[model samples]
Target: MTQLFSDMFGTIIDNTPYMKAIGAYYAGASEDGITMAMPWREDLVGDPETRVIASGVVTALLDNCCGMAVWDRINAFKAVATLDLRIDYMRPALPGHELKVTAKCYKLTRSIGFVRAFAYETSVDDPVAAAQGAFIVTALKSDATGVKS
Candidate 1:
């Protein structure tokens, strides 16, 4: 990842309260997006009987991954917020399995970015959930180094 993005997006993620609470971590990067992982934890379970990871956790994971992809596509850090997010839950995430998520920023205009993402455990073909979202891109007053110029 570029230093600017690392500073802008990475730092924000690192410091964000909810993201930190979820224990998601940066996994890798691709040409169009980035990936992250969330390990299964008892505290993340929504149903005690089923021991299944909460859907809300998956939602946060997808949103964060998609947000990261937006920055990756921009190749820099700038202010952006989710404009819309729609998630389709295919199945419950298996307990004790770390969920992996990848999101792609497929399109970007001056003020918006379109993203798609999915969550999987054992295989990408068998996704636990999928999401499509839009984010509002803002003109940030920062230079290449992610510092005001």
Candidate 2:
């Protein structure tokens, strides 16, 4: 588990394009969940005057965070499809403030996983967005070498 965490938060994380594009980074990880951060970018601005980050970006951030939490909880990489994701914007994120999102896989069954997540700029209690989602879990197939794909 320790090695998995190191690999995930280390080299493997750096090579992911979407994560890189959004400036996502490992903020923290625990037995139940993982937290990721996305720094605010001028190019991602939703309103010119307010400079608040776009709601779409927040949705993406939470979605990715939730999915990662599921993988971490399962302790293995598995193919999962987002079945449903519902995000509610509580408030607009402050301009230039980095958004931190925490997500957890609360329940896992034979075919699905339930996840919940929240996003905030300064503190978790004061969330800017909250989300609840379900993912369809699938078994990953290995190649001839017998390594999980």
Candidate 3:
């Protein structure tokens, strides 16, 4: 990760109240992607009996992961918003296990970024959820980075 993205996206991740409340943190990141992990906590459970993580929490994780991946792909700090996101839940997250999600930007256009992500406790093959997302990139940061729209 470059300094600008690490500084900007890192700030966003560190400051998000929900992310903090859920105990979300970066597991790892690369120039093309990002990975995040959140421990299973009582308050985060969607079903107390099942001890499954809330779908909403998982959705937030996917969104944040996708957003961060896009920002890193852009290689600069800029205004970006989720244009669309599609998530398919494969199954309940493993009980009492921390869920990890990874996302990568696969395509970049002048105004948009396309990404894919998945959530799992152990392996991507047995995913808890998978996501395909697109984000709208504002022109503000592109000028500085020479990304012509």
Best by TM-score, which number? 2
**What are the runs in model 2 whose C-alpha is more than 4 Å off?**
5-7, 142-149
Clashing pairs in 3: none
Q: lDDT by residue for model 2 over 47-96, one digit each (tens)? A: 88899998988988888788777777677777766888999999999888
Each candidate structure's TM-score, on Cα atoms with residue i matched to residue i, is 0.86, 0.87, 0.86
**Any residue pairs clashing in model 2, and if so which?**
none
lDDT of 2 at 6: 28
Model 2 lDDT-worst window of ten: 140-149
Give residue 84's error in model 3 in angstroms.
Answer: 1.0
lDDT by residue for model 1 over 46-132, one digit each (tens)? 999999999999999998888788887787767778888999999999999899998999999997889999899966789999999
Off by over 4 Å in 3: 1-4, 7-9, 141-149
In the predicted model 1, the residue pairs found to clash are none
Output the TM-score of candidate 2: 0.87
Give per-residue CA lDDT, model 3, range 5-112, as digits (tens).
Answer: 645555576788878878998777864368889988888889988988889999999998888888778878676788889999989998789999999999989988
Q: What lDDT is obtained when candidate 3 is compared to the true structure?
A: 0.83
Better of 1 and 2 by TM-score: 2
State each model's CA lDDT, in order. Answer: 0.82, 0.79, 0.83
